[model samples]
Target: MKNLKQLELLEDVLENSSIILPITINGKRRSEIEVAKDTSKNEIIALAKEATSKWLEEKSIIKEIYVPNKLVNLVVK
Candidate 1:
């Protein structure tokens, strides 16, 4: 779950910006995924799940995810 600060930031972006591709990080690797501003919350979650799939085999689960400055920080366990 996002903290208050992260929720606020995400809300700001969702309300004020156009579609974008955010940077996603997993461990030391990073990638980008395009997401439309009008995208549904479920879709966003699905995308995140897909992005983090490679780490699941290692028994990792997503710990945190936030869009800061349009960059997606996806931390895993």
Candidate 2:
């Protein structure tokens, strides 16, 4: 978010590439004891499942951007 111009340019390109993002909790783990102390590992995974659904919901907005129809590979060295 520090570079607004870069984010705008990225919005122009890439588009829906990151439809599913990496699970990241930046702050103090939201008191893990409450989140999943008594639950099974499967229950712990449920949190991520819910987050994915939320990400998908937000991804819909980005999908409507005006972008080129064809794909062009960038030459990276």
Candidate 3:
């Protein structure tokens, strides 16, 4: 049986755990990135770019960021 202390610890861990957000490029789902729950828009975008950097071309650039949808659009030449 789980004790109250164990439950509280589990809850704390979950509260601070990172979340996986889907990354979209050109309106298409390309990959997913993990970030903290309290991560800001800019931080999320940076993480997404880093996660998808290999797939992105040298000329690729972030054109839009939809934080609510956890999506980032990249324009690749």
Candidate 1 global CA lDDT score? 0.61
Per-model lDDT: 0.61, 0.34, 0.76
TM-score of each: 0.48, 0.25, 0.67
Q: In model 1, what is the error at residue 10, expressed in angstroms? A: 25
After TM-score superposition, the amount by which residue 46's alpha carbon in candidate 1 deviates from its true location, in angstroms, is 1.6
Q: What range of 10 consecutive residues in model 1 has the weakest lDDT sum? A: 64-73
lDDT of 2 by residue, 1-77 (tens): 66998998888666534222123232112211123223444544444445434333434221111112221111111
Q: Residue 68's C-alpha lDDT in candidate 3?
A: 56
Judging by TM-score against the true structure, name the best candidate. Answer: 3
Query: Whose lDDT is greatest here?
Result: 3
lDDT of 3 at 9: 97
- The local lDDT score (0 to 100) that residue 50 gets in candidate 2 is 59
